[model samples]
Target: MDKTAGEYHFTRLETVVFGAGKVESLGRELSRRGSNRALIVTGKTLGRSKLLDKVKSAAGSALAGVFTGAEQHVPSHTVNELVAEARRVGADSMVSFGGGSPIDTVKNAAWQLMGGRAGSRTIDFSAGAAESGRGGDILHIAIPTTLSAGEFTPGGGVTNESTKVKGGVADPRLQAKVVILDPALTIETPAWLWASTGMRALDHAVEGSYSTRHQLVTDTLATKAIELLNAHLLPSLQMHGDDELEHRMRCQLAAWLSIFGMSNTRGGISHALGHQIGPMWNVPHGVTSCITLPHVMRFMAEVAADRFGPIAQGFDLRFDPRSPRSSAVECADRIAKFIGKFEVPTRLRDVGVPREEISRIAGTVLEEVKRANTVGVEVTLEQLVGILDAAY
Candidate 1:
């Protein structure tokens, strides 16, 4: 019952409006933000959907143009192209629709439009500079279409095509100025992607809750996110078309809460490894998180057994507190089994990560020591290699 065992600061989106029919208010929100000329960003699939039509109709003349080239891993060239398009359209503000890729891209583009640089190379994590306003101003609004939960965070991930490394850009100014959470907008999301990303959100909550930097506030959000995701993700995936409203709303809420928790506490080994392997293998962020999460949990159990016990209980892993280590392993295994319910490939090789490349992947991940500052774990290179090997 010691709620304040950890102390930390919490931050979140400036304005969030969530509901079933909330997309109908898109134009009103844009106009209220003093954004008459808005650029809408989405993926190719979402661009061709009726949802895009809905957004266009809602925004009407306030919508300047649409950029549908958002891709997974957020390649640097894509960022530059989108930035050019945003400038070409003379957009005063941006609306990002779709998953983490589109959201992260627009967030970065907005930052660049506000004079931030598209990192010349892969992010140098050693340079932990605080982001300050550069005097250039362009507001950003996010309409997330999946539960990957990038919209609520102030960081964006972009891949350096030259090096084939994905890097993160952390800037408070990159946070969305307004977020409209319309579950209806998520109707177009494919089922596999939806469920896998929901598991990714659950990973965020789990990692954030037990993070060394976790605080009372973040713990509360993480707990709620866990409860919501456990209850809703499967149902959302199972009943996508039949029961759209409640299921999508729950997924949206879970995603938001996951990011809310993570924004404060940072994440753990799962994120650290996923951040490394995702871009290298062209894996989706959520899928990589799903594959690595349980293994990372098992690894973390040695140092964080006490924290794992409660999470085990929450997930209904029945075991005695005296045997916290066993219980923690059970918790990790149970999570892996739960993830299995979604039919996501649980092994790296299942997704085309060749066995021979394991060492190379591990080596690439070892280079991610820069993530240690934020990951809340002193993950050594040897330890990372072990994680990749175990996951393999």
Candidate 2:
């Protein structure tokens, strides 16, 4: 087949194990690879949960030490601390057993440990290290419990606390060698988190559809992800007992498909804003998506109407005899309603983004995009502030 206009690339993870009880295979898998000491990187909540115990049991003697300080936004200082501990313990491998934060932290630590320049040093996204092509040799496993699907991609987002800008390395070596998707482990996740992260996945699918660098294969996966999320996310949110394994699994699958095209393209304004606002406001990635995505669609209606068509169809939206732009605006409305169904906040104010910071946030978005070498979508400070104002 003739390829799309732009180039594309994807990472085929070395191994992916899905299904209940599959997390139990971690120890043997490490042993098979001759890994003797593996560090566990995760957030505080998951570290205290019985799930960590389960991961520890599975890791057996290979479990070296557990770093539970992987906070939201994956601060550069946190990465240095974790890297220090990893070296102190002489860990030979790493396991990221939580959501995006821990996974991103592990990605940075692994990169530093595997001979990247500036090992264990604070990362400055504005320093242009993220766009520099670099890879590491450390073996990392990602066992995700949320739908923020950072595990599937090579870019690891780390925030500098001093600057409050999120950025990190985008080396192929940062990709996880193994990903274990065991829904049983997710039962402990709060319904709000599960639903919110699903919205994050939705943001990925929607943005990928309109990204300038989007390719045929990525569009296909993003569309299917949209369909699956529309069909299953709500039911997954309403799941009562352990019997809803299939719903959870399908949501996880949707999250996977949502960002399956990461190696080729990057998200546009929604993601750029999310990465900035997340570290600034101390908001979760999912909440940022819930608030930013619909407004982004509305903002892009004039430029990317055709791109939103399949997404509108995925949401089962019916259109009248209106112009394509009008139909695209309706698609944005449909996304707002779909997210509203879960009772999450869809406005910036609702997420505690003060009105005064709108311009600052917009400026940060522009700077980060320029530094990261973002392609496809371009935004001026005025346009970004307008989107923020509308969301506000």
Write down the TM-score of every candidate: 0.92, 0.91
Q: Which candidate achieves the best lDDT against the true structure?
A: 2
Candidate lDDT (C-alpha), each = 0.77, 0.81
In Å, residue 183's CA in model 2 sits off its true spot by: 0.8
TM-score for candidate 1, residues paired by index: 0.92
Evaluate residue 142 in candidate 2 and report its C-alpha lDDT on the 0 to 100 scale: 93
The lDDT, on a scale of 0 to 1, for candidate 2 is: 0.81
Clashes of each: 0, 0
* lDDT of candidate 2 at residue 391, scale 0 to 100: 83
lDDT of 2 at 361: 68
RMSD of candidate 1 to the true fold?
A: 2.6
Report the C-alpha displacement of residue 94, candidate 1, in angstroms.
0.6
**Top model number, TM-score:** 1
lDDT of model 1 at position 260: 82
